[model samples]
Target: MEATSGMPRPELLQVADAVAREKGIDRDEVLGAMEQAIQKAGRSRYGHEHDIRAHIDRKTGEIKLARFIEVTDDIENDFTQMSLEQARIRDENINLGEFLIDPLPPIDFGRIAAQTAKQVIVQKVRDAERERQFEEYKDRTDEVINGVVKRVEFGNVLVDIGRAEAILRREELIPRETVRQGDRVRALILDVRREQRGPQIFLSRTHPTFMAKLFAQEVPEIYDGIIEIKSVARDPGSRAKISVLSSDSSIDPVGACVGMRGSRVQAVVAELQGEKIDIIQWSEDPATFVVNALAPAEVTKVVLDEETNRIEVVVPDDQLSLAIGRRGQNVRLASQLTGWDIDILTEEDESERRQEEARKRAEMFIKALDVDEVIAHLLVAEGFTSIEEVGYVPLAELAEIEGFEEEIAEELRNRARTFLSEEAERLQKRREELKVADDLVEFNGLSLAVVVRLGENDVKTLEDFADLASDELIEYIGDADNMTMDQANDLIMEARRKLGWFEGLEDETDETSEDAVEGEEA
Candidate 1:
């Protein structure tokens, strides 16, 4: 970041240092970023006369700027850069890396010039701060930060952190939790991006760590070195699954986080707008950990696939919905937190899965009406995940099997061919209908082609405009001639509404009424 004044003021140095320390950056880094800002402004304003080279003194609180003429052999014939032999005439001590300060007095710099320099410094400092925040929060990635709700945007949320402000995009936010001005809310910093629009402070209450951080803050063992949080998966405002590790053998991380009367964790739950939190002890053993992560519901069996870090859990029939949570939120959060792809199944589903396996196995051995479970499972283990793959196995190989016959193998192959063809067609049709948009294609003049394409995409009801972010619409029309991205995005937004897209979606209730309902409920 830039120093506020030309000569480093004591207060300016202190502020820069504080910002650097809190953000975990070096003083030189901030200074370098500030100098770059001055250079850019100077180059833009003065072109070849961009002679100002600025530096901030580390030892002494002072800023110094110098103008230098480069040195080479020919000083008279060439003045752009100095020749080494001619430069030696001024000072025998001069070197390539060093430059001499111009002989101008400090009194020569005007008030207007000083003000320009100050403005440049402020801009650079803010830019550097933004870059620093992005770097710090980037590695933190999906973790959550708690802050007071500042305000609402057009479906966006503004949160006030102690040192920074963050924007929680509508899509990144959890669906259920209500936010209001002045409410202290917790959100996951989804992304921290540097853009001309500003440092895009991406935040989300939907992320899994909101609960994890809350527990860490609430639970003493976690705050101390006795316990470490391993992973967290949350559905936000509904339920969450957290895995914790204990460093001290004597202490139970899970129970410790829950507290004596559940008061500690309950406080976190209330702040989450009444979401449920499940704390489980994490394990290095996949089978055990997967089993624990899916608790509250009994896991009958857990089959872990080591290669893919995936797990297929079979829960009792009664606990299926509980294990899955509402709208598959439980498993989704767990999958995200644990970095595991979990396939949860009820006992009935497992039975059906097994039956499906058996059917495929029987298809492989058409000559024989039935095969033992051991043989069927063996066939599955032998890269035969489906009957179609088994058909690819050589008939000579099939004949070598104890139960196989050439005629039966031939029949199996024919059936596999038929099944595969039908399945491929279904998959192709599904993929086509799934909708892959290269974003909304923009056009100059908002012509007929763009309008027609929009209609074909089922976007006629202006509601579809919401799907296109401001940037994408602008990019399309930017190549159309004279339009800017900002102008295009705004035009599309307004045009979509004018085109009646807003009429399709439900009218949003007034904020006052919603707040009253929320207050009464609380």
Candidate 2:
């Protein structure tokens, strides 16, 4: 080791090694940072405009300082560029695009220069450390990681995860779960982002995937792919529901997750701060899955409305409270796990609703068909709830109704048709009075009744209807029409097309036709 100027200092290599070890960075990277710091110092000493550079020998730790001037045909920069003809005077081997390196003696560092060099080295080392941390943890998302809580700021926990620091946001912590400094915690790596400050590693204990990963760690069947976790829903430290499916028929997914004597599930529950878990067997059928998800409570029936992506669950009156759970937690978790909106109902409530619907239909039949109460009740009992059904069903189907003859069926059909025709005429008169345009009235998929309703809502012209959003149109039409969003969009687009809104766009019609075909296939 030498302290004199223009001499190699062997201690520099030892310093680089120590810094690399302490910072967890590559030795070569630390040496590069040292070289950059020396180069910055050299530039500050020798004119800043000069192309000054520095290098350190890996073997001897010898510092080399130089000014680089490119041998170019055109000299755009006096400090860094030199003409080839002028370069040949100094060295005959110099060629175009080659650099002429003029070595200079290394200078002793002053206090200010030494401090500046230290700052540069520290910044470069920190940058390398941040890059290393990001590369190490960026791909480790969704993995369970153990760390010690370093500190807490504004409810956010900063954990020291060995080589890096991760943040567990307050919202990501389980409800009512408290953590303090020096406490060991396990969480899932939800995300890793490269921000201006550094690479941010976000951890979450409340995420549903955290529980799934815990089960994977505790349950061999899940880790081995014998059982797959289909979905998970968590109410933080309170309760959770996990749906799983088994690939092997002999293996029961729920039983495997539960483990022998509840050992496996208890491990996960303990990690989750005593969160009660309900492990349910997943089914391909939505109805079956919903039933399985709502555990500890018996469901007598489940009616699925695929159009609305909702399910109506019917349970015994005594099971109502159990099905709903405290503050609707059970059904809410079930809905999240199954991805279906659930409406829980008791058997008594369902029965009353059925009777009420029947009564309404019977009254409608009595008024529309001019039938007595007995006839209306018969129609309702026979599942003929609409005048359209009575008018258009096969004559034999109506005649086959008990206590109804062919003549009576024929008479009922005639009366129903008359009532519908008269109603249509009345709606048409109303539509005319409301000044609804004929183009809108005759639009396909817009029934005369729907048109009248739209006119009542002041959507009389095709332009007005076209201006409405799908949801707005559905709202204005009311639920009686059962208009889906897609249907409403189609109707609006058709109106737009008729109003020349899509004019001069050659591909519009083709794209619309292709979409229609795809929709039909779907």
Candidate 3:
């Protein structure tokens, strides 16, 4: 019922303070660990079933030991619980949930108990140290850190980063870069994870962000926010490309990063073991950015397909190898830096492809419209590629073609319309033969021709179409309809919604809307 006072053990407090300072942990945490050790020892001396507890005085460092017995109406455990009547014998004012504290004399720890207590304290302190390390480094991902190599095992470098040890794995090291014990190296803190043993700090020397961080360290403009490193792509120990942007109009990002006579970039290259770096200016336009990224190789034309996030780059025949780099490295790095898939082509190749496409279009028109080679060639030359374009285009646009009059334009349009109508009838008949589901036939965003194509591809039912991935649907329909991945996804999603696949989502949305309405009313 009364507070327990024990003999002072100031040496324990001193040890706790020393451990806290050395381990970079709170002194209270060390003291609490000491209390747990004392509690465990007390339970060993006293009955283990008794609720033994220990506390150290914050000021006097006195170790207090006691047994706690709960006062309850029902006494289930005789060792740690008592009936309310028995508890009231000691203190009548004690509440039912209150504990009856019986002060016990501190036991003189035996050699075995002392050893056990020491192990407990050491384990608790180690756990606290690991927790502190995880807390300190978890938020430091993507940051550059400097450390000395402590050891190398199986090509993995163990780095001593002052208070903590980090691992630079073999795969994350720059190729052909060597590191021995005691060598100081800079790496990006790729990740910090908590595991069963302790917190693991992972570092990488070959990460693109490591190069960007190096530039940030070397170039004052970048650190000062005048210039920003937008993206980086690296073939570690070989080559790298970095894109930079300047918020200040007068500051040239590329020139600033290059430093005086290329000093800054050279420093990064040296750190990366002579990895070649191409510092390019970043642009908001993907095409412009791609062109800049593929620098040192002149580009004649760039065609961007935004739907696919791909770009076709055309260069002179002599510059083909240079544009593509050795083994396509240049274009690959350009793709990574600009966030676009890049396909490089020589000027000659592009010209041949254009001519081939034109020839195919002319042949298709000649067969579909029953027109002569001259008429089809004129139509193809005027950029008409399909029967739909020829039929739906303004009569004046077709008549404007050289050597074509209004009468000829009208006649060609009629023939194109007739061909498309007849083709639609034929496809419809095929769709019927394929037993295409009516629901799939009526699905929005799909034309009768596309539906027929889908039926031919065995996507005859709504369920079949819904089961297909967006890319698969695009593949099944072919490029004749110019179907985009996004459109395909939308159609599939609509089909799934109609099949009640999104019922749970709809319920959640309805609940959210109702909650919003109720909140407004309140």
**How many clashes (backbone N, Cα, C below 3 Å) per candidate?**
12, 0, 0
Cα error, residue 430 of model 3, in Å, equals: 2.3
- CA lDDT, every model vs. true structure: 0.67, 0.92, 0.92
Model 3 residue 463 lDDT score: 92
Candidate 3's C-alpha runs over 4 A off are: 469-475, 484-490, 502-522
**Candidate 2 C-alpha lDDT tens digits along 1-522:** 122235667999999999999999999999999889888898999988899888888988989888888999888899999999999999998789998888877868899889999999999999999999999999999999999999999999999999999999999999898999999999999999999998999999999999999999999999999999999999999999999999999998888899899999999999998999999999999999999999989999999989878999999999999999999999999999999999999999999999999999999988888889898999989988689999999999999998899999999999999999999999989998999998888778888889988999999988999999999999999955888887789889988898888786757888889999999999
| Cα RMSD for predicted model 2 | 5.7
Candidate 3 residue-wise lDDT at 151: 99
TM-score of each: 0.50, 0.88, 0.93
lDDT of 1 by residue, 1-522 (tens): 122335445764676687578755677776676555555444444454535565656655465545556655445534246767766787798876455445322223356655765676666667666776666666776666778888988778888876678888887666665678998877777777778866777877666666666677788888786899888777666777788899889988888888889988889887777778888889998878877777777899988876557789999989989988878887787777668899988889899988786676655544332445555655655556555566577877765656657786676566667666765665445434544232333423454334444444465434465566666554443433344555556766675666567764535545667888999999
The candidates, ranked best first by TM-score, are: 3, 2, 1
At residue 144, give the lDDT of candidate 2: 95
Candidate 3: deviation at residue 18, Å?
1.4
Best by TM-score: 3
Instruction: For residues 213-285, write the lDDT of model 3, one tens digit per residue.
Output: 8999999999998999999999999999999999999989999999899999899888999999999989998
